[model samples]
Target: MTTVTEAVPPAPAKHRDQVATSLPPARGQSFLKLVTLELRKSVDTRSGRVLIAAILLLAVAAVGWQLTHLPRGTINFDGFLAAATSGPVMILPVIGVMAMTSEWTQRTALTTFTLSPRRIRVQLAKFVSAIVLGAVVTTGVVVLALAGTALGGATSGRATSYAGMGGEIAAGYLTVALNVVMAAAFGAVIAQTAVAILVFYIAPTAWRLAGPELFKDNANWLDVFGALGRIAERDLHGMLPETLTAIGVWIVLPTLVGLWASSRREVK
Candidate 1:
């Protein structure tokens, strides 16, 4: 029997499924790293670079316009800075909108959300990046304004008056932050680039024109643009509460909505 029977091969060992030994450390990583990534995104793309160039060009044009058109007596540092900043202020918020909406518009949300599952931090990083970029743009415009001021002063024989300029410069930075971040919040809530920009511009402009007619004085509290105007004028002394209220209504509320919208939006 032993000679006739072939020894059966040992039964193959049953395969067992192995469990994952460890999980990845929660969703969080480095926030600074996230901001750095966002800053790269803002400046790295062709469109982004084009927009930056356009902003600088428009700023230079503004300075040049003032140099050519304005009376020499009025071509002081303050007026030049104000003129130079105007074009950028209008354009800067577009960058904010792009910062918040570009991922959605370009269909990169899936990867972004996948890599950084906590979406709020991602939104915040983009917002911070927009602010930083706005600051850089502002600095550039300030330099142009200064150069123009020097030229204007030399040609016109008017001393570069810095009477209240220190205050105005500080106020200008505040206005830029408020507008850019507010636009970013709007973009985050909408998650669409074109529509967000349209609304961000139209809504405030419409209110600025009509709300004063309809709501009388109460529009001050709801008018972010008006508050920003007051801030730009460095005239918030008597109306700090109302100015803050407007900022709260426009900036803080929209920012909260944007964070929530971004976090919960489907990542398809």
Candidate 2:
């Protein structure tokens, strides 16, 4: 009789388990990296580039016009800062809205959600990018204001007080940043660029116009425009409560709603 061949041995169950478990740890994108990507995306489009250029042009024109029209001694740093920032502040919110709505408007939501999966991170990245943009614009305003101030002083031989102007300027820029964020939140919730922009501008204006008649005793706390006006005036100490309430309503509430909508919306 022929001898039977030896049977082959199987791998140990523990060894199999070890092989299955041996995978590289999962790596996700960092917040800073996401912010950088978002910032690049904001300006990569043609519309974004045009908006930025237009903002710069408008800022320069505003400053130039003020210098030409206002009396030489009157063109102080504070006034110059306000004039320089007005154009950017008015339009920067539109940029924020575009950033938030571009994914849906451009039909890239599918790819974006697929790559990131967690939508909150994407929204947060957009928010951070908006803040960064606001800061950049604020810096530009500051530089322009300084230059204008120096020129006015040289031309008119007058010196203006720089005492409390710093705090006021900072508060004004911070309010602008907050407004950009609020617009982005609205954009995220609506997911439509035109609708979001319309609502962002119209709602505040309507509220400001009707708030006193409608809300009466509570307009100060309920009206975003009034609260932010106080903020722009640097009345932080006196109006802190009202400011917080307004921010909670306008920025915080919309942001929460946006996060909810973004998380649940189907990606097609």
Put down candidate 1 lDDT per residue, 1-268, tens digits, no spaces.
Answer: 3568678886544422222325444555799999999999999999899999999999899999988876745556788887888778899888899999999999999999889888889999999999999998888888998899889887777767767778888888889998999999999999999999999999888988898899998888788877889988877768888899989988999999999989889988
**Against the unseen true structure, what C-alpha lDDT does each candidate score?**
0.88, 0.84
- Per-candidate TM equals 0.86, 0.87
Q: For candidate 2, lDDT tens digit of each residue in 203-228?
A: 98888788889888678787888777
Badly placed stretches (over 4 Å) of model 2 are: 1-26, 72-75
Tell how far residue 12 is off in model 1, in angstroms.
Answer: 20
Model 1 pairs whose backbones collide: none
What's the lDDT of the predicted structure labeled candidate 2?
0.84
Cα error, residue 149 of model 1, in Å, equals 0.9
Which numbered prediction scores highest in lDDT against the true structure? Answer: 1
Report lDDT (Cα) of residue 182, candidate 2: 92
Best by TM-score: 2
